[model samples]
Target: MNNIDTRNPELEGLAKCPTGIRGLDEITDGGLPAGRPTLVVGGPGCGKTMLAVEFLVRGATVYDEPGVFVAFEETAGDLAKNVASLGFDLNGLIAQKKMVIDHVHIDPAEIEETGEYDLEGLFIRLGHAIDSIGAKRVALDTIEVLFSGFMDHAVLRAELRRLFSWLKEKEVTAIITGEAGETTFSRYGLEEYVADCVIALDNRVVNQIATRRLRIVKYRGSAHGMDEYPFLIDADGFSVIPVTTLGLDHEVSSERVSSGIKDLDAMLGGGYYRGSSILVSGIAGTGKTSMAASFVNAACARNERCLYFAFEESEGQMIRNMRSIGIDLGPWIESGLLQIHASRPTVHGLEMHLAMMHKLVSEFQPDVVVVDPISNLISVGNGLQVRSMLTRLIDFLKSNQITALFNDLTQGGGAMQSTEVRVSSLMDTWLLLGYVEENCERNRVLSLLKSRGMAHSNQMRELILSDDGIHLTEVYAGTGGVLTGLNRLTGEAKTNAAEMRQTQDLDAGARAVRRRREALKATIAALRAEYESELDELDASIARERAQQIALEDDCSMDER
Candidate 1:
């Protein structure tokens, strides 16, 4: 046998086939190895058959490459009905000659183990199905019945190995499913070692909740995410959510969107970036929803589409609740500028929720997406899972240049930290909301916890909700803390009173100085008048003296004559 070069295809330029599964194609680097058999082993109800059926179905539907599915355990009709709920008309595809489904029923009791029995019959059936449609893809779902039907294990293993190699020789990409063994991944321990790629599916219950996951156990020539990823089986089909994207290569936007509250937007450095993720975390009854409503209104006012993922309340209830605060989301909803999707967080697993968001985002193509009370997702998933989902969400939104706003409902009365601690670090901006008590009354407080790229105010503003909408009041900090509510009014009163008194004193002192200046001016004017009169008299006396001297000179001249 020639030594084969088995390296990651991503680096070796080996071709790959796209699975067309939502995130599965991305996770597997590009999908399974092209024209090679991939072994899918998992426990019952783990979606082995579904995965195989989807592989062939997508190959024919999306790739335009015809496929054949050979069922060893299920009949063609049963297989068709099973995936019909997923909207896959396997029978219709068969009628169109785009796909072929062959059922190979093998009975162990009817077969005699005296002769040399290879998988010639199985090969003939698979070949006929493939040749019927000129298929480039084939699926042998759950190959464990072959072992139960065949008595010789050695002959079965040899035939299985030959079967995989022969499919590769025919250049048809095939999928082989098997029951999971306790120690080995497959029952016969023969498929995994022979196939070019191996994938494991799992459906486990944790904390009374079921989570379906998929993982790539082995790949002959491709680099893939080996971590167990969350997958969802919804009406659309199987969708895998990769934990997160590779790097921060997503595009950033310089455009800013208003936060709805004018003063609050001013504090956020002219609002959030277009493609950034925002976390509005706060304790209950602290205007978190009001803030989110303001953002939605602003987005709709811009004529940009916005999606509101409401987890706490229904659409009508949320509209009514927001109306109480003077935010008329009803008009926007009617106008179709805003879409509010209200679903209970407990309705599905976290992965399913993520998948829903992804689907809506893709369909709506909204400029902004709002997930109200993201903290509620924690009840279904652990911290790591939530973080992973958030990371992926943020990456997707950023990549699409779509703004995502997440509202986190804190647990305790002022437990802002516990709500979005894991997601806070991933968010582009974190707005913390809390309550301040003064004069035996509660007041809503808003403060910026962090902002990644822009300069934001560090001061906490008093969040005032009224019929006019949310208003952010300038907060004054005294020795106690940020003065709010009645305290703020009292502080403003005292400050105004002090300023008035100081102005009054300054005015009184100015009057006194003006009086003194007028008196001094009068005295200087009188003194100048007196000095002028005295100088005039002295000049007259000098003139008279000169006259007398002239007269004496004239007398002397007459005597001389």
Candidate 2:
């Protein structure tokens, strides 16, 4: 979007001059209107000066477009000293003839009301400065100061129009800064109507935390983002976060990424999808951070870059704590495969934290990102704000094809599946962790609440954290409901004992039946033998009685034969 040749053809009619600042060009669809005057209005200390100066500096340094800074509020030396912290060397640019800074000092005490006041002398000075460096960009710091004591509305409006027309005729893109008015965008209310584009800057404090935002109030002849984007001004200069730029149209990957625990991956049907947003929600002491660290460790083990955002604990503290679970993040940090950014959630507003996350992810180019305990963000913003911020963050990470794992803390005494920030709907996969109390013992349990595009297990498993690592064991479920902790062990033991006793009883019954069958067979054998002996004895007695008859029978048998 920043590239001139690659910008959409529809936006080609309105030529845009790239601001060269990170994320600014994206929201503008290209950048500010080219060869036109843009009014930047803001309250005091709202970064109007910094924004104007950085615009000029970026033009001169990055785009190779020489720019002139006509300052009405500060001298050239003061301007240089003020912006030096942002790494902009005004003296170097001036020495190289790439920039020109001219201070137009206006003293109200010396000013006298003259008939038909016009900025004729100011034009000559500005024109000379523009021509001296062949500047293509010009910035007027606080143009309202030029006519400080003027009370004629007609004169102020006419001169403002004339000045804007002159800049247009010169064909140099100009930025005119103005103080925010009580009821209007600018003090004179007419600057916004006259300029080609108007940008508003706001510095608001919520819960004692300051957050800066930028909004494009109007952009004539161009379609631009109207949302108030969070911007950061630090040592790296201005960076606007285009949170809404990414939508749900990002391409998805079928590839899988491990959840770091072997059985947990099995429950998730091979693991979470690549480029997916996973939410690990649990009550306190349910190993949310440990889960996040495990994912980070797994990612780092693949030689992939990982970024861990720790809001509750410092980097060293997290590293040391994770070591207890056999997850030593120190080596990954030392190898440059992992970066741990630790800061209290209250240190900045939710949007600022979102902006910093965007910035770090862009710079680090990590394959996986882990935000430990995203619930801490609730301290800075309401539930809706946190949800919005997380939605944007998830979209941003998905758009970049970075797998993100967020640790969310679920409040106790609430629905086990519900998270305090209510961002569960934004996650592609949600793993709910909590304590399952049974038989006078509390045991950590994990269950797959939901996983998009995969068959996930709904059964709860006992989550065990040992010295070696995390382990997931199947909990015992029976007529007594789901059993965990010592109850599960006891149930298993009882089942085993019952099975063993049943086996022993069956063995004894089979032995007794075999013994009875053996005895019966022996008795039958004895009875048959006794009958044979009786028959033999009867035959012998018959033989004795029939001995005489046998002789007679033998004679008869011989006669019959």
Candidate 3:
């Protein structure tokens, strides 16, 4: 049989392997160095094997790069079955002669090292498998197993050097996975000096919260990210997300899109900019999803295609439930104006979710995208990973000029407080919804927390969902308080009671004033009559005096006349 040419001169200038993992390639500046051995050193259960397997599988499926998997720990069958849940058909690939899986079972109890033991047998087997299928990628999972089975450390080290030289000679991009020790990184104690690239994976638990971290310790002759990045492992596989290093060169758009609610649109100074990301954060049952759905419906009504990614609820269930709130997604779906992609947060890795979303966005070419309750996704990964994932997602949407809406569920008495602390700075517009207890009953209130590059109403508006659809009524500002929910009605009643008391006080004062005025008028009339009677009596007395004195006054009167 003609020996396959394993030597590749292009390996010196080879591009990084894309890995086909969303957000990960961006962090690694494309992918791991091509045609070179990279050491993946990690503790137990840190996803070393999973990452290697995924790399090989992605190469096989996505990039059409045939690969070989050499497992020193588990049998080839077990590896295949374990990853079957992730939708990888390793056995089929092997059967099709496109891939090779070599199980290297080396039991320490069976080893009788009378002389120098060389890994020449293992190398021969690897060459046979690779030559069989012309494989371009190879993975040796947990090389530490071979070292642990042998007590001859010097021989193992010498053999490891030869193995690396042989792999370089083979010219296939190789990944060597080794178990991490308690203090040192690799169990073999050879990772630091032999590998062209070193990658470390760590899993840590603090306060009942488990977090996975990945770091590129060293990469020879190439610039690489040095910071520890966050990652997640789910149904699909491992995904690494590096935090964004924001640059001023990001694309910007001045185009605007309509808010689903007319009044809310008016409040937003026209509407949100096209491609701008809006965050709707609120407590449980605060209608965040309803608001997002209303916007999606509005977009659909405008004949603009939209995608809704529901993490907490199934598409069918969401459709059925939202119908009661006046949002009928079924018609939109049937008309192809709306598409709902619903999946659990843990159903797949964050990278897988992002890749699926990227694919959907490309295929649908939607004008709007909605992620209902992004906080549920936050639960699947660490803080750094979640933040990085969101940043990349937002950047992708912004670059594409796709209007994106994200919902975040808030917890505790100050539900949105944590969200504000964590994610508010990343959002272009922040909408807050919550329960307000003003009266004896509770009510729902919606408010615009902030809107960048646009003026927005600071007042809290009451959101009402009737048969007509979602409605935002005028903000109620009265003596009691602003209208929230049932409490607003109670506040209105209290305000009315206070106003009635004031009215009754004014009526009592008017009655007292009328009584005093009537008493004064009667007294004046009586005084006037008494004065007239006295005047008449005085006139009669004067007349009688005049008559008696007439005889005497005749002569005086004649004289006076």
Top lDDT hit:
2
Looking at model 1, residue 53 earns an lDDT score of: 87
* Candidate number of the best TM-score: 1
Candidate 2, pairs of clashing residues? none
Model 1: ten consecutive residues of lowest lDDT: 1-10
lDDT of 3 by residue, 1-561 (tens): 223344344444656776676456766677877777888899889988988898888888889988999999999899999999877899988887778889999888998889856778888899999999998889999777877788987877888888877887887888899888667778767575455788899987643456678888877766778888867775667767666543435577777788888888988988888888999999888788888988998899889999999988888898887898878889999999899998888766565576678668888999999998788876666665667778867877777888999999888476455683267778899888877765465567788999899878888888887676678876568754566666555667887898999999999999999999999999999999999999999999999988888788778878888
Per-residue lDDT over 1-561 for candidate 2, one digit per residue giving the tens place of the 0 to 100 score:
467666666566688999888778888888888889899999998898888888889999999999999999999999999999989999999999999999989897877776776767888999999999999999999888866756676777777788889998998998899999999889878564455899999998777777788999988887888899877787778877776774479999999998788989999889889999999999999998988888888888989999999888899898899899898989999999999999989888886788789879989999999998899998997786677778888988998999999998878999887888888888999999999876678899998889999998889999999887799999999767789999998888999999999999999999999999999999999999999999999999988887888788889989988
Measured with C-alpha atoms, the lDDT of residue 6 in candidate 3 is 46
What is residue 423's positional error in candidate 1, in angstroms? 0.8
Give all candidates' CA lDDT scores.
Answer: 0.86, 0.88, 0.81
Considering TM-score, where higher is better, how would the candidates rank from best to worst? 1, 2, 3
Cα lDDT of model 2 overall?
0.88
lDDT comparison, 2 vs 3, better candidate: 2
Q: What global local distance difference test value does model 1 have?
A: 0.86
